[model samples]
Structure formats: C-alpha cells, structure tokens
Target: MNKQHAQHQIWRKLGLLSIVMVLLLLAACGSKDNSTTNDESNAQQQEQTTEQTTEQPAAEQPGATVYPLTLKDDSGTEITLDKAPARIVTLAPSETEIAFAIGAGDSVVGVDEYSNYPEQANAIDKVGDTTTNIEKVTALQPDLILASVTMNTQAIEQLRALKLNVYATEPKTYDAVIEKIKNIGVLLDKQQGAADVADRMSQVKADIESKVASADKPSVLVEFSPGWTVGKGEFMDELLTLAGGTNVAQGNGWYEFDSEQIVKSNPQVIVYSSWYEEPNAILEGINARPAWKVIDAVKNNRLVEVPQDPLSRVGPRLAEGLQSLAKAIHPELFQ
Candidate 1:
C-alpha cells in the first residue's frame, strides 16, 4: 500500500502548486500592464493640457474690439469709431499709412487711389478717388472706413448707414498726429505697436526741438507750386517751427497771397512743394514773375524744392519732413 500511494500524492500536490503559481504570475502581469497604460494616459493628458495652456495667450490677443472710439480730427470734425476696426478701408493716403504703422496693415482690404506707401498696400483694391465710388467700396465690404473730414460728409453718412465704422482724421498739430496714431492703434487693437511708433516719434521730435531751439529764427515762406501760401495755424506753420523759422503765413490758414505780400514779408527761406511729378511748371511760374525778385528768400536763392510725396504726407513721416524743412530753412544747422 505505501510507496506507490506516496509517490502519486507528491506528484499531484506539485502539479496543483504549479497551476496556482502560473495563475498568480498571470494576474501580476495584467496588473503591471494596467498600471503602465494608466501612467501613459496621464502623461499624454498632461502634455495636451500644457499645449492648450501655452496656446491660450496667443488666442487671447486683442483684435477688432467691440468698443467705442470718440475723437476729433485735424479738421475739427468730431468722429466716432464704435468698435475695434478690423477689415479696414482707408480713403486718405495718410490714414492708410497710419494703419501700417499701427500693425494693422493686414486688415486694410480696400483703399482710395492715393493710398500708396509701405508698397504692399498698393496690392489692396482701390475704393475710388476722394469722391464717389460708394458702390465700389460697398462691394469690397470692409467693416471699417478711415477717411478725412475734408471728404464729403455725406459719404461718411452713407457708409455709416451700411453699418460700417467710419473714422476720420483731423490732426491740427504734431501732438494731434500722435493722438491720431494712438486712436488708430486702439481701434485696430495694435496699441502696443502704436505706442512704440509714438515713442520713436517723440524721441525724434525731441532731438529736432533741441536743434531748432539753438538755431537762429529765419522768416520762412512755404508755397505750393501754384503759389498758394499756407497762412497761420497750418501744416506749413508746424514745419517752419520745427525748422526754427518764422512762417510768413502765421495764423491765416491757407490763402492766396498777392505778390505784394511776398515782397512785404521778406522771407529768409522759401520752400515750395508741388503736387506734380516734375514741379518744373510751378518753378517756371515763380521764376518768370518779376515780382519774385523782390522777396529776400528769392533774391538770396533760398528756394528749395520739396519732394512732395513724403514731404507732404503727415503721418510718421512728418519727422522726416521736419528734417527736410530744417535743411531748407537752415542748411548749415544740418551740415
């Protein structure tokens, strides 16, 4: 009875023990796999959350805010922009230039025929001239329109009726120009860039002021090619001040001065700007007149021909204009 029964019993106990050990090992492996899978899932979720968190700031950028902007322009026209403007259409060339400076040039979808600067702006569709072409502008379907109050007021009203935001520029002085830039920056949600530009302008203006403050004041005559003089608080007056010169036209705005006024004022420097490409015709008109000889600026050969495009534009470029005016008024100061 004993030896055979003992051997079978020992073998049966060993086999059962082996089966139990195999089941336990399989359970342990399953548990380990489950833990690894859960860890990987948690790691993936954390990475995704990090990525989303990082992207939120970029997505939170200010763009075309829905707020009101009420301000006056150079022409003393009170204009209101009731939201941050995206998708802009500018009627004035200088206003479009301001848009570019404020980092919203991409938003300008349409412009008037004169809005050419920054070069890339030339690619945008032209709404029309300073007058008419309302249908053309409407076709482009811009959300905002930047213009001058000098343009027909009815046009602004018409655009407004279509629920478009029309912001007008009316800068009376250099400070007002800075304000206009800031307003445009706020309107386009590019306030940061605008502030930078404004700061740069401030530095330049300060530098020019230092130079002008030291210079001898000369009598300045700023004339258009056709002999139209800007009298009194005007763009020419500002330019003359920057050049350390006294504007002969001080306080009368723009006017047609008789030849006698030119003789009587006895300006020390004469700066003429022509809207024409050559401006030779205007110069010819000036030289041909015997009355031009009487003016001190003319007799002294102080006639300077200003490069009309940049010199005439009243945006960020006005600093350069001031430099040009300084040179015209006092070439020795620049040298």
Candidate 2:
C-alpha cells in the first residue's frame, strides 16, 4: 500500500512539471508573434514618414507648375501669359510707373505721353496720349500691354483685335492699386522686387498713419478741376481720410460743384493738384473769387498744392502722395 501511494505522488509531480513546460512554450510563441507584429508596424510607419518627407518640398515649391499663368484684368478680360514678359507697352502713365517700379522698366518698349515720373519712362518710345496710337503700339511688337480707365475703349479694342496681350487696369481704391502692382510683378517674373516696393509703401503708409493718429481732422476740399470735386467711394476721399481730414464732397463719383456749395461746405483747408501747370496762378484765381473769399479755406490761406502725378497716378508712388497730403494737412505734426 505504501509503495502504491508513493508511485501515485511521483506521477502527479511529473504531470505538474509537464503542464508548466507547456505553459512556458506557449508564452514564448505568443511573444514571438507580438514581436513580428511590432516589427511590421514599425516598418510601415518608417515608409510613411519617408513618403511624407519627399512630398513636402514638391508641394511647397514656389511658382512651380504655376507658369503659363491665366488671370482676369480689372476690365474682366482674361489674359494668359506663356512666360515672363520680354517686351511691355503701357498706355497709361500709372501703368508705366508700375512697370518701372517692379524693375521691368527695361522691358517697357513704349509708353504714353504722361509717363514722366521715372525719367526713364519719358525716354521710351511714345505710343500717343491716353487715346493710344495703335500704329505705334503695333510697331513696337510688345509681348504685353497695360492700359487703364483713362484709355479710350476703342483704342483698347483695337490693340486687342491685333491679338496683342492687353491688360486694362483701373484701380478704384488704394488696396486695388497695391494688388495691381503685385499682379504686374507676377506677370513680369519680378515678384520679389514688386513685393519689396509694395511692402515699403505699406510701411510708409503705416508710419504716416501712426504719426497722424492724434491729429485734428479738419474739413478739406480737393478741387481737381475748376468746379469738379471727387465724392465718396473714391481714392481722393481715401487720401483725405488718411491725411486726417474730411472730404466735404457728399455725392458719389466726380461731380461739379458751384460756388454756393463750396460756401455751404465751409471747408477749413482746400487742396489742389498740380494739374494746373501754373499752380500759383490757379491758387490766385481761387483766392480772388468773390464767393470763395467768404470760405474759411480761402480766408485762412490753407490752399495746399500737391504734385499731380503722385496723387493722380495710382502706382508705387501713392504712399509718397499720401505722405505729402499728410504734411500739407497737418504740417505741425509732421514738423
């Protein structure tokens, strides 16, 4: 009986040992499977990381796959440039100034009569006045042509009829003017150069605004012509606001005002453009007007004369014009 009991105990011990060995072997197999899965996951993650690294540069490349550009002009005309313009013709003085500002002056083959700011623009072949001489423009063989609202519609159509690339620019606001400069830069492949000029103008504007923040805003009037004044929703009005003044013109668009209206507005300052070749003579004429004598602007002698082109032409020099207007309106602050 004792031997049989001893045999039973040894068998039970052997069975327990066998079960422990089996459990250890199963654990080893499970660990191997988990290691294989982790290795596969790590390989996939590495592959994905490599793919992302390679694609980043191609996606972020500037101006790549963006050539042969297509865009719409202010006139809603579609224009496509196969590449950067080699030869450009500008029909407006403002457009001519913009081309020169963007460092594309060398490519400007022809310009209108009024493009006289850069000195270099005057040296270019003249294509006529705002009317645009089609014959001379055609002779220039320009790869690109820029026009503005001042250009006659018939002349613009004639240039377009010749299958010449013509972009009409008529920026109604100050922001629009900067956008036009940027677009012109992109077209000329001088994007960085254009951006630099635009940025500088922006800085100039900000600086002027900061300096004039606490200035006393006085009522002002801009007599562009004898009896004409720019109303609300125009660049002239914008300039007045920037210069810490108020435009007394109430109507929308350019309109004629009589002496009675001028007296009623009672502006504190009257700003005129150099449009009149003889600015002094024009100011004298205004000062001598019997009805204008009653107005505060004439009595106080706050008739400020600003350069016509810088204020009139919506181009790179717009900031300069704004600064000049600020100086004229708030001379004390500027000084």
Candidate 3:
C-alpha cells in the first residue's frame, strides 16, 4: 500500500479504538449510577422497616400521659409518675377514703384492714394495717401507693427502697384533710370530683358554724378510749372549737388523763368516742375511776357518745364528725 494511505488507515484504526473505549467507560458509569441509586433506595427501605418494628403504635399509647407528673407528698418525698396509675394501694383507712371520695376508687387495688367505709372498701383486698403486708402489696403490682403517719414507718421506708412510689399524708386539721383529698384527686386526674366533695363538706361545715356562732361555748372533754383523750392541735381539738365547744384537754396531741385532772377540769359535757364496740361499756369504765362521781358531767349525766371514725379519721366524713360533736356538746342549739 502507499505510505499516505497506510498512515490514514493507522490513524482511522486508532480513532475507532478511542471511540469504543469511550463508549465502554460511559456504560460503566451508567451501571455505577444505577447501583448507587439502588443502594440508596435499599437503605431507606431498611430504615422504614426498623422504625415500624421498634416504634409503639398510636393505639397502644395510654389515654393520659402519666409521665411528667411530679409532686411532693406529705412525707416531703418527691414522686414522679411515668404513666397514670392503673393500680393503687392505700396503707391507711383515711387515705383509702380520700382516694375513693375523689372518684379514684376504681384505681384502688388494695387497702389496709381498717378501710370499712363506702361499703365497697370492705370488699377490697386488705393488705393488713399499719404493719402492712409488703408481699401482698408487691404482688398487686401497684403503680402508686398511698401512705400516712398512721402506717408503720419502717414498712413505708421499705416500700420506698423497693422503688415503689409512696405518697404519704399526715393532715392534722379539717382544712388539711380537704386539701389532701383534692391533692389525691389531682394525682388521679379527678380534680372536679375532689372539688365537688370538698365544696359540699365546706358547705355543711359552714351551716353548722352559722347555727352555733352565737351559741354558748361549753367546756368539753373528748374521751377516745377509757382514759385517753385528744389534746390541742389535733383534728378533734379543732372540731371541738368549730362546734362552739372548748377542748378541756390541756396538752398538745393525745395524752392520758387521770380522774384528778378530769375532776379538776370539771368539763360541762363529757364526750366519749365509739372506738369501742360498746360505748356504754366505755362510759362504765370511765365512771369506775375513783372520785369520778363528783365530776359535774358525771353527776349531771351529760355524757355523750360520738362516732369515732367521723371524728378521728382524717377524711371526707370529718364534717359529719363536727356536726355530731356540735349537737352532743350543745343539744339545745341543734334542737
């Protein structure tokens, strides 16, 4: 072949080879782009599957958010609830009553042995009294627990150590009792129910106060047991004052009184609580004290008996106790 023709043929072959190489590179780049796109799509799909498997369904969420609910109990311990308590345990009769009164009765899964009010309370599982059955309480798997000073302190501490949420109450006055009731309501999301119950109790108390505001205030002695009487700063003492009667017991809290002090105090009306099954038996025991006959209350037959639960229990029935004591101390005014 001629020299020019040979050079042209070589250049044309080189050009064709370059064109083929370019085409192959383009095909490889297109495959890499498709592979990358497929990889990205697979990663997104796997992430979506993982979320579906791990995340909770909206329907499975609780009706109310229990988390973020935090408050300091009467014992001064701070408590945080993760979810609204579906099961509750009460360690005191008064706490049980307050819980039920605030429309949280259904939530109470267990109560102390002394819980007898509201009739239904009697049917609830009893986990013992101040000496609570921690095992039984634990078995109930209560989300929330109610306690008080009345319960054994040791047991409360043990429950706390078990990581159980315990809210203690030690309301000493009628107002404090109402506040506790409302607080329980708030804890259980029953604020309206608690407010209504508290309002009704206040109205009843106000009525009694108005009726005896101008009445004569008499010196009264409240006998809890045979010789035990409540003193100042107690719910019973405040109830006496509210009912237009002065508590003759001198010291604070509860104390034992002797026949000498009773005679010296000379209470116009002697009041006995129905803690004992037979109130008359309590009166007999009181009368048995030496030199007791000389007391004005004994000689004048001014002894009266009142329901112990209503008077002593720090719960919804405290207003009833106030009225009962008012009538007992001043029958003429009530009549």
lDDT of candidate 2 over 107-204, digit per residue (tens): 99998766676889768999875356899999999999987633335677888899999877655566556666766766677756666776778778
Runs in model 2 lying further than 4 Å from the true structure: 1-65, 279-281
Model 3: residue 8 alpha-carbon error in angstroms: 99
TM-score of each: 0.75, 0.78, 0.78
Q: Per-residue CA lDDT of candidate 3, range 68-184, in tens?
A: 466666555778776668999987666777788878999999987767778998899989743589999999999999876433457779899999998776655666666666566
Task: Summarize candidate 1's per-residue lDDT along 1-335 as a digit string, tens digits.
Answer: 13333222211211101100111100110000000112233223222211121111222332333345454333343455555566888876677788898789988888766666779878989877535478988887777787664443567778867876676554546655665665566557685676667677767778878887877898887764354555554554676787688887743654456767778888888887544335355477678779779888778898897654445455776667677787788778778
Ranking by TM-score: 2, 3, 1
Candidate lDDT scores, in order, read 0.58, 0.64, 0.65
Query: Model 3 segments beyond 4 Å from truth?
Result: 1-67
RMSD in Å for all candidates: 32.9, 32.4, 33.6
Candidate 1 error regions (>4 Å) = 1-84
Whole-model lDDT for model 3 versus the true structure?
0.65
Candidate 2 matches the true fold with a TM-score of: 0.78
| Error at 244, model 3, angstroms | 0.7
**Weakest lDDT window of 10 consecutive positions for candidate 2:** 25-34
